[model samples]
Target: MGRKEFYWYYKLHATTAIFPTRSDGKLSKYKHLGKAGSQTYIDAIEQITARTRIEALDRSIEALRQGLKDLVEETSKYNKE
Candidate 1:
């Protein structure tokens, strides 16, 4: 997908979280991480990383399949002659 499409996709499905506020009523810098830290943040990071790796593997598999298909066609043509 293009940048704009991916941006909208995430924007539509993104989760919302409320963080603790400061004395002045400003939002915390570590909004997602939370005050004392959170397992959710770690899990989210891991999940995203795993998804990226899976996508890379899927692309690699498709490329390999295409290469093998091309090689088979070439070999068949050579044998016919």
Candidate 2:
């Protein structure tokens, strides 16, 4: 059997992403996923906070549908006037 290893991605500052090397200043072999403001990073965090990606996506889709429905109703009411 083999074990999977994980590394920590700490944002030293708000601008860039860097692998914090040790006192020897050596970067680890871990791959960088994505930057903070990028869509990948946002989705990853959302999935972590929510039960699952499907649930998070469902919530967003439902909100959009409701907003569209409201806009249609408002437009129809205005047209009726």
Candidate 3:
């Protein structure tokens, strides 16, 4: 198994309900049936990374939204006074 095969298997599993991902993020037993088991433990750090990027992005978006809201409210108050 190689990086290419693992990616292919990953894509295949994502498309179909055949091979399931385990709680540990590894492929299920059925994955070996396709002969991709050899690359199960391998990872691809070049093209992808699984970390807190999504969480950080969400927090940034929320902060921006709240800041915009606060600005709008303060401007409206100043206009009235």
Candidate 4:
């Protein structure tokens, strides 16, 4: 299908491409890249996506660990025979 939308203009654009600001306050573009550049552009996008996912998971795991630790500490305070 034709380009229904555009994002990451800064990451993937031709050397001669120009994105101008439109009068309607929407972003305007002059050119889009074909499948002509080196594979590094796509590789970078994948790496960035993976890194973001890993970071989010790490934060979630740490939060769960802290919650469990707090629960154990509170339970240990109960009197025992």
Candidate 5:
């Protein structure tokens, strides 16, 4: 069989029989879709990328806030001198 056919065959047979509950109480079925070319794998990669971008932006905002606070403190000290 070709690679695509093999992937579908594997996916069909690799699924688990049990549906487990997630932390939010939603029922989720387990699928063995960790194969590199699958849609689910691609989605997971995108999610990770988005999360990383968000974290970097948050750090930048915090650094800017700290810089502003330091500038204000310096201004107040100079005015009092």
Candidate 6:
């Protein structure tokens, strides 16, 4: 999801779950599902980190390919002599 969508969804669920209403239509005190909420945030962060790592890895692989191509061309030139 995009930036705005993410914030909306996070706020929506947080509000609904933390402030559930009573039978008489009274809103209860906000209760945090502490560890679970923490875990959710941790998991989201890990996902973002994983994406960053993957992109970095892809760039490194491309760099390696270019370096290897240069090396191979140099070796071929030496063999031609």
Best by lDDT: 5
lDDT of 2 by residue, 1-81 (tens): 776876445232323334545576665544244567667567656755776767889999999999999999999999999
For candidate 5, what is the lDDT? 0.68
Ranking by lDDT: 5, 2, 6, 4, 1, 3
Task: Report the C-alpha lDDT of model 3 over 1-81, residue by residue, as the tens digit.
Answer: 556543334332234444556566655534432333434424322223453666778899999999999999999999999
TM for candidate 4 is 0.49
For candidate 1, the C-alpha RMSD (Å) to the true structure equals 14.0
TM-score of each: 0.55, 0.37, 0.42, 0.49, 0.61, 0.49
Put down candidate 6 lDDT per residue, 1-81, tens digits, no spaces.
556542222322343444555456555554333343577556755766999999999999999999999999999999999
Write candidate 5's Cα lDDT for 1-81 as tens digits. Answer: 556545331222315544344456554555345678678667766866999999999999999999999999999999999
Clashes of each: 0, 0, 0, 0, 0, 0
lDDT of 6: 0.65
What does candidate 1's lDDT look like per residue over 15-81, in tens digits? 4433445566654434343322356556656777999999999999999999999999999999999
For model 4, how does the per-residue alpha-carbon lDDT over 1-81 read when each residue is reduced to its tens digit?
Answer: 798876543244435534544455545444233343436556656766999999999999999999999988888876442
Residue pairs of candidate 2 with colliding backbone atoms: none
Count of clashing pairs, candidate 5: 0
* Model 2 alpha-carbon miss at residue 80, Å: 1.0
Candidate 3: segments with Cα more than 4 A from true spot: 1-51
Q: Model 2 reaches what TM-score against the true structure?
A: 0.37
Candidate number that wins on lDDT, 3 or 6: 6
lDDT of 5 at 18: 49
Error of 6 at 34 (Å): 12
Candidate 1: where are CA atoms >4 Å away? 1-37
